[model samples]
Target: MVFLKVAPMKGVMRFGKKGKLSLRFVGPFEILEKIGDLAYQVALPPALSGVHNVFHVSMLRKYILNISHILNYESLDLREDLTYEESPIKILEKPDKELKKKKITLVKVLGRSHAVKVAIWEHEDEMRAK
Candidate 1:
């Protein structure tokens, strides 16, 4: 297995927006065979079927086998909208923001909204309405 480097060349478009993008190596593709002196054919996913598979030896990196590479995917029980309902378990804190005209109250609500439950700040009036 190896990682193929992604770079910009003549007549090539970049993967990211304007500025220094962090797009680097793409994959841990299996090497099919050595094409010539310095090129090896790589097995790319269907998403990259339109791209060229052969890469230079300098653009390839040997991948060390790591247990962390294995993915443990857990299916989420989603609703029709693809979002699950999350109820606020507790109000962690209440803070007042002094605006020019009036003070706005915010409540720190703890909820299991995501896989990892996080605390979110919400308006006090909105929280009461819900």
Candidate 2:
């Protein structure tokens, strides 16, 4: 079993509106064949048929599945659309800046996962208005 490494921004967009902040690695997919010295063809699900199954070695990580350990580990429930729902936990910081005649207020949000180092910033006024 191997895990696929997806870009953080792309993964967030694909996961959901709020994004599955903790769900970085999406699969433990089986390797179909070796494409080259640095790449391998993987067996992807039908939902990901549009994406090429071949992936570079750097994008894959080995998954060690232990039956006893699996009981304590929670797997993400991927939807039919290959997305999961999540939300921001709180606002870590609120800062304001003056740009000419307008003032923009930005809020640094803490997402569901503690592993997220980069905070998601949103326009406070826009978010509040919405």
Candidate 3:
């Protein structure tokens, strides 16, 4: 018998809520389809373990606000529908070589925008609560 481990996730966002918007994952858009004005399913990676939920709008804003930096494109004419994913869980408690190698990477994806830019930086110690 084979037993596959399942992930624990919670409702990060909901409809009819203030500051709520739409977002999608760069991948898995097929397995998790969006039905226009409906919703899109997201699969959290291992790094996002223990994460409960996130604000759809805030998540979108993070990408939108950093568009200039991420895409290096000057013009916003390319309003391509894209998705961004970030781990909501906390890491760094256990410093493993593999986990360190697989450290959380801040990624940004813009649709049809090849010039899009993605930046990754180390989090401040204060940023991580003890």
RMSD of each predicted structure: 4.5, 12.1, 20.9
Q: Could you give candidate 1's per-residue lDDT for residues 40-81 as a string of tens digits?
A: 999999988998989899999999889877766545688998
Q: Give the TM-score of candidate 1.
A: 0.55
TM-scores, all models, native as reference: 0.55, 0.47, 0.18
Pairs that clash in candidate 1: none
- For model 2, the superposed segments whose C-alpha errors exceed 4 Å read 10-12, 17-22, 69-130
**Order of all candidates by TM-score, from best down to worst?**
1, 2, 3
How many residue pairs clash in each candidate at the backbone level? 0, 0, 4
Q: Report the lDDT tens digits of candidate 2 across residue range 1-130.
A: 7999877663346645435564567788999999879999999999889989999999999989877544343456668998765456778999898898989889987665423334688889765764
lDDT of each: 0.83, 0.77, 0.33
Best by TM-score: 1
Best by lDDT: 1
